[model samples]
Target: MIVMDSKAQLTVDIIAKVAEHKMTIVNAAKLLNKSRRTIERYLQQYLKVGIQFVVHRNTGKAPVNKTPDSLKRQVQALIKEKYFDVNLLHLAELLEVNEHILVKRETLRSWAHNIHHVKRAKRRRAKARKRRERMESPGLLLQMDGSPHRWFGDKKSCLIAMIDDATSEVHAEFFPSETTVGCLKVMRDCIESKGLFKALYVDRAGIFGGPKRCNFSQMQRACEELGIEIIFANSPQGKGRVERAFNTFQDRLVPELRLNNIKDMASANAYLKHVFIPQFWQSQIQVKAKDRASEFTPLPTHINLDDICVIKEHRKIRNDHTFSYGNKLYLIDSPLKYSIANQKIEVRNTSKKGFTAYFAARRLQVSEVVETSKFDTEELEIQKKLDVLALAEKLGNISEASRLSGVSRDTIYRHLKLVKEGGADALKRQETPNLRHKNCVDLDVEKTVINFSLEHPHLGQQKVALQLNARYGLDISPNGVRGIWLREKMNTTALRVEKSLSLLKTA
Candidate 1:
């Protein structure tokens, strides 16, 4: 039997049937189990559709004494003049509270529509075509993304999210910053907690891969060692699931952080781990259990998380009871009195800064630890920039500061404007006073040229200018020697270059 929960719809159906059968309202009500007044109303509506005698009595009735055109214009003008950006609901409340003008929600919606007409509403672009869902098994494809957001209400933080392709369950915590180390830690946690995913999907970041010109980056090399395959998205659209999840998080997660009063990454991580994850899983997730049954293969429990998270290096104990690690020396306290020099040992760098020595998977004591100093100007620059940035963050005037110390206010402001998007590292200076050298096999001719230039004070440049096409059968200028001497003087302690080179007797 055909059934409808709505009585109004049933009445409409009776009216439709009565009109079709060319029956009177009284007869229609007798057949349809409705009151005569209801039948009369139905007959009236039926007749309005050109069925003459059965027209609805209220067909052209005024809409509850209609919202006057003048009042609508007043509301719209008030919006454009004073509250253009006010949302519809708020605007409606404002009209009721301020103007003593009550409005239907639909009427307010109509005002919005008219405003669009006046404002030349932006045309809606065609939505992107929906992609076909390609389902992968659990632990097959892990989507990894760094969501840099205000995880804590007080400050911004980044959470390195690793979600299972099948289950959409996150694997780790909120991070202080979005860095390769943070990602590595998250991935390590995932592997130790959920076992290795078949492949990892990530954006085209340096931490995942490099630009076309560069070879496989350090991150790619690290992934290769872990036996995890990497997949990179060419566009954000390709990673829509995580992008959509981020949108949801921006709305809900921020409010949650506010509620929890999360102020830093550590607290946010605790919330994520202890409270949010469980609640979210229960409320939002729908997992298809193994084999159509409500059962799951519990994650393996034997995997040691620490073993995979650390960087291990093999070293040899030297005769001095010290071992070298990436060239840094660590003194080991072996029970044997003699040095185990040239003997193999293992050095492991866990989460901590200090070196942990292990002899065949067993921990050993280190007597002393020391690191070698290497000439890395780039490393020094990076460290200096880090310190500068940290200080800049402390002092609110970093935005007004410039690379050149004590720069003019105008210049500093101009540079800051230019480098607003660029970070503190952008405001660095390079060393100058470049020099070059060239050699010829003619000693006598060179000495002759040199001696002549040294003796002539004012004519050195002029003679060199003229000797450009006739210098010992070479097209060389005397300014070349002057340039060389000037450059050499900058680096040498010798008071006089002419006196020092005087010892080189002419051949």
Candidate 2:
């Protein structure tokens, strides 16, 4: 009749047996793995208070240091309403600092699991990783990485971030996609604010150093010029700190963005810098080093950050002191302009400042030519079309060209058609507006198509189109559905084929 756990019930039975002279106190002590005095105490309690006395005195009573139910409820309410996405450890710190309610991470986790039924999916067991020691001071090393995630619900974005190896302080900016420009901007912002770090620890992404055999990428070249050493991680685990930061961002940042209604990269970047980062640091997630002195070096007086951080390309200055970049001719002017004719010059272009020409460490005045002759425009347009076609030809497919250039297959086809009919000049000609045709489907329909393709992955274009027509009452051609699938990079057949081949190999 005792409503108790197995251990408690066993203790009650043993006490009853000892009291009835069936079991000796010494034998009961041995059975219960307790001292003789403890066994005697339990028997005495049973004699005084009956079978209920066998239960521990603390049973059905809260501990002296137990958090109040009201406080626990307040913490749960705050977590659900405001800090729903924060991890348990961070939530505990936030509760103590912000809400003045002290709680351990384990306690918070237990409360959340029992009261709120909050659960996280178990991650796959990873290989054993060797832990890397953090640097002793800030700026000794900076770990840099890019995380491409659905920061905004509407679209995916790449967050280029750099974190101090010692302090774990992070500086990140959201970009449309990870590129050299984004990396440069993130590094520039970091350096301008915190000074230059000794070295950068980054992955061997194409934007960074790329393959060992290839020439230095723009980012690598810029880092070399700035006297910053680039250390490439042999594996993702080597840069675990930055990778873990990205994990936190995926967990917390997305929900914060949703709550704040941040839809664009600009707004997301601002929120990340001004709000989330500050709050994150305040949560005391980053541990402070013993030595507070920073190892970051100040910018040299002779060095120009703009020049070091820009995208530099070598071009030959024409006889007229003009150089063409991106199909546009730019004229370089200087006191020694005539002397500099036919000389190889470096064209430095930045996102903020347009373009500047430099030769042998000397900056030259550059201006874009607004006026273009008909023959020149025709020639440039031809060259541009030929370049696009050449890239497509090199890749051996329009899909690769579209992926690399961020151009649509339709545009590539249109350009190729123009090249076939009227040569390169045809590509330069303005397209007449098609007033009759309008988009049959909106963004919602496009999202629906994408979702359906993901859910019913084996369904082909024709079936998908038919399903959409039946479900949404919107008639869409098979080709239209195919285009949508292509844009989303959802080639289910190829994926299924690859998966089958992998399974076969395993078998």
Candidate 3:
């Protein structure tokens, strides 16, 4: 006699046919390509048809203990209000300690969907694309991005961040917009603090490179003056280092901000400089320096970083031992003050209050007294109106007046008196938008190089040159393009290997 689960009656049916036919068990086994014993067991299940027939064999054992309900609830709450990007294991650890629950990971994961009520947001992964793998030595290449998040925890301001590709160190500042001015400020800060990098790698956003114009932008000119190469990624993936860094920052940084209770940009930046950065770099970033020597070299002594980084102007002391800055007259208290009227002096303005005045390195004490003048007050109001109109016009809007002079409505309001007194010339002293750079490259060469790189990322100079000549119309030497790309800091990734190899040999 054979016996089997009734739920498997279909297989038993076939076995019953052979048994009902009085066929030998060997014959049934041969027909089904199964063991004789297996067929016999199915034959017995068919005979017992009245009750207990359709049960699964393994249904009775209880499942392993599940994660506690209270623990799951707490994790769900933390994820809902904080640490949205933290992964499963990190969450598990937090739950075990913070919620005082020791739960198995498998059990915890089983309840994840039910607890959270939503699937985790999928993080963007960089897709593999056909492009040259470019990298540079530490401090050689820097990547920049603008994050328009409420970084200060008060929903207040947007921050622009610049990170070193080799070390993942950040130089960030809060800005009103992700504009060229914001980018230039970050760049100026980096250059002043770290000296000139070999090149800067940035996205092809409008702020970074203008409308693909033939001429260089004012920002580009400033970078060129510093001998810093400006390189634009062909696509966002090319600037993946900075993009991914921001993702990680969005994860861990928010909690840090909450812990410190940072509610404003000034306090947040101060925390970043003092508490956050030192701990972050030590914990996360890998050292990619060539050797034991420190990668960052100090800035040159002669270069006054403060002077280069700041927006400055030349002024002369007036007859009343006073000087004017942005329409405010500040009286100077000089020890030898008979009268220093018409003497040339320098004024340095920063984003913060308190402008510094100097005469050839001599600090001049500014009088705290408020001086009121009719002409000064009038000029101030005129400037204010012009600024408002200028800002409105920049957004591609119209002024109240019917004119295509690109003047803002606020500008019209600011210079309404000025326009009544003078003309459009009163409002036009040259309105520059504090732009500092532009993108410049030979289109033909760029195409040839980019195409060759797509085919062979690790191609040597000679091989790339041959491909360029054979396929593209360019007849340039391999060394020529190689020099150009290297000079621009675009090929630093490949150069790092050679540097690493050299270091290994020395070691």
* lDDT by candidate, in order shown: 0.63, 0.83, 0.65
The number of clashing residue pairs in each candidate reads: 6, 0, 13
Q: Residue 190 in model 1: shift from native, Å?
A: 3.6
Please give the lDDT score for candidate 3: 0.65
lDDT of 2 by residue, 1-507 (tens): 558888888898898999999999999998899999999889988999988885666978989998888877888888778887777765776677667888877878878986664647459989988777889999999999999988896778899999998989898999889999999999999999999889999998888876862858988998998899999889999999999999888877887687678898778888988988997754655789757999999988988877788899999988888889989888876778246777899888887767777899888887789874465766786676678789999989999998887778998998888888987667776756333236545678777887777667688999989998999886788998887766556656776455445656897
The TM-score values for the models, in the order shown, are 0.44, 0.60, 0.51
Best by lDDT: 2
Q: Once superposed on the true structure, which residue ranges of model 1 sit more than 4 Å away at CA? A: 1-132, 188-193, 209-227, 285-303, 313-329, 335-346, 352-354, 358-364, 369-507
If ranked by lDDT, best first, what sequence of candidates would result?
Answer: 2, 3, 1
User: Model 2, poorest ten-residue lDDT window?
Assistant: 432-441
> What TM-score should be assigned to candidate 1?
0.44
Candidates in descending TM-score order: 2, 3, 1
Q: Which model is ahead, 1 or 2, in terms of TM-score?
A: 2
Residues 41-73 of candidate 3 have per-residue lDDT tens digits of 666665676323334455576557644567667
Task: Indicate the residue-level lDDT of 85 in model 3.
Answer: 49
Better of 1 and 2 by lDDT: 2
**Best-performing candidate as measured by TM-score:** 2
